[model samples]
Target: MRRFVIGDIHGGLKGLQQVLNRCNLKEEDKVIFLGDYVDGWSESEKVIDYLITLNGNQNCVFLRGNHDDLLLNYLKTNQFNKEWFQHGGESTIEAYQKVDSKTIQNHIEFLESLQDYYIDEANRLFIHAGFTNLKGVEFEYFKPLFYWDRTLWECALALNLNLNRDSVYYPNRLKLYQEIYIGHTPVTRIGITIPHNIANVWNLDTGAAFKGPLTILDIDSKEFWQSDPLHTLYPNERGRN
Candidate 1:
């Protein structure tokens, strides 16, 4: 069965739907979603609802994202963080206003049940963000780093491609996995509107929260599909731009 890795959705349910349809997934195919499923668009609640139903019909793996964590905290405690609101949380809060308490509770449970990271039998590491430990994810001291860290990506970007893996300057963390797939930080930040690879780390976030399209990459073939830019799909909304 083929394996597909999807980037952040950021409440762009239309974009999500488009890419999934384009993929033409089979029942046995594995699908891995690198979080940020909510916030930025008008359908955050609907996105979560769709995913909950999708899980039953598909072989799916969902990773936790920082935005997802913030929403979960607000749902569970009724405490709001100002930073989260400024960074697209307002859209999520607005979307949830019409949702029933039972639905909200179910969403909360789904959020809580998300995995911090997943390592397949092929030795490919899939995480929402980066792990800080040089020894690898199992030795990560800070749990939040799994969904919050950018240092790992930064290191991958900064590395000289010519450097030998056995060299003293080679990053120990990069040696831990055959390949690492992540989202969280959008590749659009670097002016890339598609999945980008730095060393063995592949960044799939094409910034659907802003001006770019949602992306899904075939892990084996490296072929990919994208939806129309989120701005075009939801012209009335500003998204997180």
Candidate 2:
């Protein structure tokens, strides 16, 4: 069975659909989604609904992202976070306005069931963002760091390519897993619109929340597929720009 890891969707349901189709998914294959499934375009509620259905038919792992946590909080408390609103939450709020209470409650339960991270049998760590503990995820003191941290990616990027994993100067965090897969920090910031790798960390977030396409990478073969740029798919909307 092939194992694929997908980047952030950010309510770009069309892009999500396109990539999934292009990937030629099979029932036996496993798909791990690195969150931020909502809050950017107009279909946040639909995206969640679609994911709930997808999970039932396939082997899927969903990791929690910061934006998802924000939406969950608002759904449960009815208190909007100003920061979340500015960063694509307005679209989510509007999307849910016409939905019935039962559906909203189901969505909330799905959000609450999301995992902070997942470690496969191959020892690869899959997380929505980064973890900070030197002792690794099991020892992480701050739970939010699993979905909010950027330092892990930054550390991977800042490392000298020549540094061997066996070298004393290599980061212990990097040594903790066979590989690490993450989203949250878009690789588009560095001007690349594809899955990027640094040290052993593979960042799959190709900025689908903004202008780039949604991406899915085959964890074993390193092959990948992407949808058209989100801007092209949602021409009428500005996404998170």
Candidate 3:
């Protein structure tokens, strides 16, 4: 069975469907989502619905992103979080509003069930953002760094390829895993429009939160599949501007 890891979706239902169709996932194949499933676009509820359906038919691992945490917090408190709204969550708010109370509760439960990170036997670590200060698989501290850190990627990107492996600082940074896959800070921030791999860390977030396409990377092969650019999929809409 093949393993596929998808990057941040940001409410691109069409893009999500396209990637899944392209993968043609079999029952034994596993799909890991790096999160940010909602917000940015107008079909947040639809995206949740589709994921819920997919869970019934496939082995899926869903990680919680910062945006998802905001939505869950709002659900528990029933208070309109301005920050959530500020981050293109207005569309998500509107989407949730259209659904019935029961459906909304179900969606909230699903979000709560999402994990902060995933580790496979192959030593690949999958997280929504990055990991910091985690001594081992069981980190005594639980923080949003799992879905918000960026310095890890920055460090990985800045490393000199010719530098001696023994001379590396913080070499044990993510010692628990042989490789890492993350989505949160889009690779576009570094002036690239596709997934970037550095020091075995793969940044699969191809900026679909704005202009790039949705990316899905094969865990073993490092091959990928992507949806159309977000703009082309939803013209006249600038998601999370």
Q: How many steric overlaps are in each model, in order?
A: 0, 0, 0
lDDT of 1 by residue, 1-241 (tens): 9899999999999999999999988889999999999989999999999999999999999999999999999999988888899889999999988999999999999999999999999999999999988889999999999999999889998999999999999999999999999999988889899999988999999999999999999999999999999999999999984
Question: Cα lDDT for residue 119, model 3?
Answer: 87
lDDT of each: 0.94, 0.95, 0.85
Model 2, position 73: C-alpha lDDT score? 96
Per lDDT, the best of the predicted structures is 2
lDDT for each residue of candidate 3 in 1-241, tens digit (9 for 90 to 100): 9999999999999999998888877899999999999889778889989999999999999999988888888777877667778887888887887789898889989999999988889878888888666474357265778887887788788887676656646455645578988889988988877789987788999988898999988888888989998878889777987
Query: Measured by TM-score, how close is model 3 to the native structure?
Result: 0.94
Question: How many angstroms is residue 141 displaced in model 1 relative to the true structure, after the best TM-score fit?
Answer: 0.8
In lDDT terms, how accurate is model 2? 0.95
lDDT for 45 (candidate 1): 96
Q: lDDT by residue for model 2 over 1-241, one digit each (tens)? A: 9999999999999999999999999999999999999999999999999999999999999999999999999999999878889899999999999899999999999999999999999999999999989999999999999999999999999999998888999999999999999999999999999999998999999999999999999999999999999989999998985
Sort by lDDT, best first: what order?
Answer: 2, 1, 3
Candidate 2: residue pairs that collide: none
